[model samples]
Target: MKIFNCAQFVRNLSIPTLKFYVAQHQLCPDLMIDWSQPEKNIPKALFSDIRRLEAVQADELTSLEKKQSITLGLVRWQDDLKRTFCMANDSAINEFRHALACDPEATVVFGAGSPEDIALWVLVYREKVFRDAELHLAFQAKTHGKYWKQHLIPKGLDITHDQARLDKFCEEVAQIYQKVGAGKSSHVEVTERAQDGSVQVTIYVEGPLTVIAHFEKNQFNRLSTRIALETALVYHPSNGIVESVVKGGAKNHTAVLELFGKHIVGQEITPDVVEKKEFRLNALRDEMLEPVLDWSKHGVHKVRLRRAKFTPVGRAGVSFQIDVPPDMDKPDAMEEAKENLRVRHYFDAEYAMESATLIVYMSPAQDGKAEHFSFGIQRLGASTIKNLSSKNQAIAYEVLKALDIIDVLDGPGNPVAEEQPESVS
Candidate 1:
């Protein structure tokens, strides 16, 4: 988790990339004598300035002041790059530029941090600007792991679990990738095979950068355009669930699923048949019951209802938010409030429970240190766990799974339970 310095990142950049930025008047504009001919010595001055800023002693400024200075420096760098891209005439670049324009806090999107962290953000920003087309296609393919969504294939379908079928499916996916303009060159390959009778396939696509400026003379330019989108397909034969991390959006997701059905299952798969795993209001309530989750068994010491929000169905722009005291050990008050609202027809069968925040006190594990973490659970399967450490996330996922909140894929193509219409007693 070592963060690299921004100065080091800048120093590592190829001369051509530095020249490209300088030529476009993106860096150290005041030092450039001629806009037409960017001086090779400009990087030295730029590096010197960045190093000087990095060399500032901690005692010289307060933490807040240092952060403010770093933020301003990073924001200025991002703004200059954005301004240059905004003036680009290319359609793809223009589209990206428009997005950049819309995102006023683009520099801080990755979160404000140390100069090294900001340096990584700057690198990402540069890639987005220079290789907008490739990134766009990769993004379309859902290259980012966090955003990967899951879908279940019907167990009733006659799925042929063999190498031949998988090979054929990969071929079809490659063709589809090209047809969908994912890239100029595309290939699908088997990336991993799990011992649990699951296989992972990756769809890689490469295309030329959409920027108007040509960087043919630059050695680094070759890598800039080689978009290797890891659109993964992890098929679990045990339950017929295909965890898809695709590049394209919903349309492409459907297309790929259709092909998956046709090639592997020998059947036509429609959106209706492919079940999406999500949390239902009733399921949430059911899981909250004591019988479902034994806190002691799950190493949970205590649970507190922090907040709950609900919207009455058919009520336009109306919602209710209940904020519970975090220190309150008993959830009886929140439960009573819900009952009160339900009896009054405010939270009846027509009510849609949106989300709930919970503070869970976990029993000490091997580390032997008890900890309490807060997390929010949404109806659409998005749960926000405040502590982003992998261990904490895994624990959260485990707890949610135990509560039948997340990854609750029961049976093949089992649709998420619909909200039950409860008659007011």
Candidate 2:
């Protein structure tokens, strides 16, 4: 049959089709784990014997792709491999959620196989959930015509006797009536009516996964259309590397929307709303930057912050002046100095939390390159230090006060002193 209104049909089928693919890769052979369970259902398995099952699947998936099934020998080998891996790493897996948070994308936690192997699958499955939603939306937008006639329309087109006739009508309409003048056609009212009646839906699964979309007419349900629509998403393949995380404005919404096309054109948030989002984002930034402040003493050289500006990306940024010893980078200079020369540090900033942190990155030269640093700051709240018996709020307060000083200095410094300082104080 000629393709008439495929967009609507594709969107309708998006969820089920994508779920089928995830089930193939995710579901246990005995169906002990239900891939359809949403995020909230995952807390129990956070400490379950999930690794053994994952390892078995990994081995079986590899062998099955090659030979199509686990033969008797393969089964025996798989069980033996599971026994060995489980014996070695079962307890460690349950204890190490934050152990690999340093490199969340590439970091591995314990599983039936290597933590690396399990992390690889985790990232993959998460993306599968996203991509499935995305493709559905794209398909729906592409084939909305088919959906309009077959599903959205009150009296659906008759397809049993004259499929060709219906297809031809849809093709002609899609091509000839693709663009309509405002208020020129009666169908616009009907289309708008369908959209208004449609329900916006979202499904969030634990393990850092979420699906958002809508149910329109009968067939098309776009899952998590907003984030999936604009962001460039990719599921990691085995041994794949994710270097950095990008938080785009499109996917990162200030508030949730119930319907897909209900665009917030002129809506403005109250000052209080803006402050809330900023406060939370800052809190998260502080949490992410906490590790850097663990060590107090500098190893060899000290870094001085001269100037800094908050980048549009909203992370810690700086224009630093470093103290470099003479002859440090000379051809015959000792190897260690070369490695420790560069500067990298991060400081966390939180408005509500009375505490923050400064992290210093010390990357000494390995073979022949100059070293670099990475630094950030994070603010603490009731939650971050709720469990610790004794916590330090001094550093956070001091750093924030210092930041105020920097802001003042950078804003309206002494133009009279532009001549330059006479000597280092």
Candidate 3:
């Protein structure tokens, strides 16, 4: 039995959004409350229903009811938006109750039993109405993370919205997941496809986990630990561009590309092309790095170059990483950093910049609460934009493209050069 602070959760949500979610989900059909006038009576009615449900002890629930509850819990927990909404609502309601209890004049409403315990269960009912809902906009408002971009060459395959072709692609993805030790259960589905033939695919893998110890109800307990991993990819066949937001590491990313090549393209991507892409940013690092440091013109403030990594020409094994302190704003810092590397014979000719990490501060919805977005750019046509809203992500991408940081594509015209040994100075 999990305990939730039901009162706190309800208080935090905008009344309109809560009303919308409740109405959309039909959470309390029996209450028969008028949703049109939610501000006047909906919150009170919702609390009463939660209290009644919570009064029913776990032991009193029938076997079928218990099973249903577990199933519903698992489903809601897996979704990003529903889980967030429930947690937020629960926290807000609990806080509200606490405030009321502390106030001498305000009477605390002690309905019955522990209503907080069943709050989440009540909100996330058995029905699967929200599975296809547009809750991403709401979820994005609450959380943030990094998104990585990559490019893929479709070769012979013609990208389309054909159902049979998409099903075949999903089958190949499942096979690839098995080969990569991802899991035996894998689901691949097309989430969206644009008019230009670019497709957004989502891959989910489930695997069993081993835990040494578990604790529940203040007693020793053992529970099944099955975890699910998700990866999102958008492939543009027109230009052979693929952008991925992966949930795991390099192996998972490699598995996705391998699936796309072997199944869709009908040809395996060569090791050289698969491993390295044509990234011209190294050659234009000096010209681009400075301009990006001052992004006030793009509506982003306090943009700073935090770190830069450089690999020596003809010496792939040797590299230099310079960390720029926040207070250090010297224009010659990069040059001086390279000069220091020359003394150690690590700077051959000119240091070819490989990657850089930049930190930018911006506010979402102009709410005055600025979030620190730290993003990294690799010369190998990969860039990571982190902790940004959807609008800010577009702005960041535009800024990077305008500066030629991520313009190079993975294609045949730009072949990877063989490495050579550096001559002794």
Candidate 4:
């Protein structure tokens, strides 16, 4: 039994947008007052009011809003006409009621049921209701980690016991670490930063054991370091070596693996063999990256950088769109500027979209008050991004990053790299 709470509403949804969602789903009014008009649309006011209600319990709301907003919500159950009446009269209930008495489309129904049954009905209908709702709100706010849950579980640390092998691997890493540090280059400074500015080769052993090796280059400063690390080993687990190499920057970089030639207690220590394998690894890596490059060149995906700013809209917050492609249906390939690799992969997996204009507005703190802040990525081609899934939004974000259309900005709306000034106003 899932219910659409206030927090979910605020995540990226607006009143009108939700109304459009209800209309799109043709969600039945929570309580139909009459029988003749069985199919009725939930009043736009209902959704608008819900958006306003969100401000009551603002702290719980995920999006950054000024006022407090509510967290609870009602799951309307259609049992019987009498039950509908009973639920509606209680002002405490934000229950959906029949539209105005004059609305002939309203239908009167009757019955009694358990909460699960009520939830069942709501779930069946609300999915489409909310799926459409989710699309409408997706672009308005970054809606991740905000969801309805029946239970909660704490995540545990990600360490396993394969002690002995890991110990040996880590020892190897330490040795490599010491040697690399000893031979530091005066021209380059190697730091333990997360960027691919350097390549890392991790060795994973077969007891399901794993080890990591890192290789870094300071192109800007002209220096490089290669370091390897191993994990702890446990009982006779499947032992195997893991290898990974990461390269960064616009230019191609190469890595040379230097493994000391020494045979282990039972295994053969082959240094030259490992170096030869490194060449194969590099070639494979290049092959894997080819699809991303091809996609970008063919225009299957277009990247753009975006600068976004959040401004106060009444008690809520609104994000304005200053630079976006003219075609909204065309997915706005956007991403954070720092995530270059992620952006590249995003362009590789692409989807076709139609064009449309989506204006997202949130209701103000008080009743009858509303604020307009963000425009759904104006799909210039055909369908609005409002039709996309959260995953789709994520990919779209990555493409945007490749284009440098991320939310990051410099002084007073200055894009990070001004050379790519977007033609869209």
Give residue 419's lDDT in candidate 3 (0 to 100).
9
Winner of 2 and 3 under lDDT? 3
Worst 10 residues of 1 by lDDT: 416-425
Better candidate by TM-score, 1 or 4: 1
- Residue 421 of model 3: what lDDT? 11
Better of 1 and 4 by lDDT: 1
What's the lDDT for residue 255 in model 1? 77
Instruction: Determine the backbone clash count of candidate 3.
Output: 10
Model 4 over residues 1-425: C-alpha lDDT tens digits? 13443333222333333333334332233312232232233333454444454444344545433231122222221222123222222120111111112323211211332322222222343333222222223212221111100111111212222445434433443443343242211111111111111111233222212344544232334233333222111111111221212122111111111221111122333211111100011111121112222223322232222222222223343333333443323322222212222222332232111111222222244476543222233222111232233334334333333333233221111111111111212
Query: Predictions ranked by TM-score, top down?
Result: 3, 1, 2, 4
Model 4 weakest 10-residue run by lDDT: 276-285
369, model 3: CA deviation in Å?
12
For residues 1-425, could you state the per-residue lDDT of candidate 2 as single tens digits?
12323222222222333244234542334235454576444324321434444455456356664333323333543443232233222222221332233445424223233532342233344433223333323322322111110111111111122334323322332232223211111110000101112221222211122465656434567564212111111111121211111122322221221111122112222211111001122322221222223323323122222112122124354322222223323221112222333424323221122222232223355674543232222221111111111112223222323333122232111111111111111
TM-scores vs. true structure, each candidate: 0.44, 0.21, 0.51, 0.19
Q: In candidate 1, residue 344 scores what lDDT? A: 44
* Candidate 3 residue lDDT tens string, 287-311: 1254433455566654555677777
Candidate 1 lDDT, tens digit per residue, 1-425?
A: 13334444545445545555544442343332332435455556676655554444233564776656654654566554443332222333333333454465554532443333332333445544434333333332342234355566654444465777777776666666665445655555542222234555556665334434355324434333444555566565666666666656776677777887887668876644344345643544432434244547656776555666777777566677776666535553257456656444434466677777766777878988888776666665445442233345545555665565555443222323211111100
lDDT of each: 0.51, 0.26, 0.48, 0.25
| C-alpha lDDT of residue 93 in model 3 | 35
Better of 1 and 2 by lDDT: 1
lDDT of 2 at 317: 41
Superposed on all Cα atoms, the candidates' RMSDs to the truth, in angstroms, are 15.5, 22.0, 12.4, 23.9
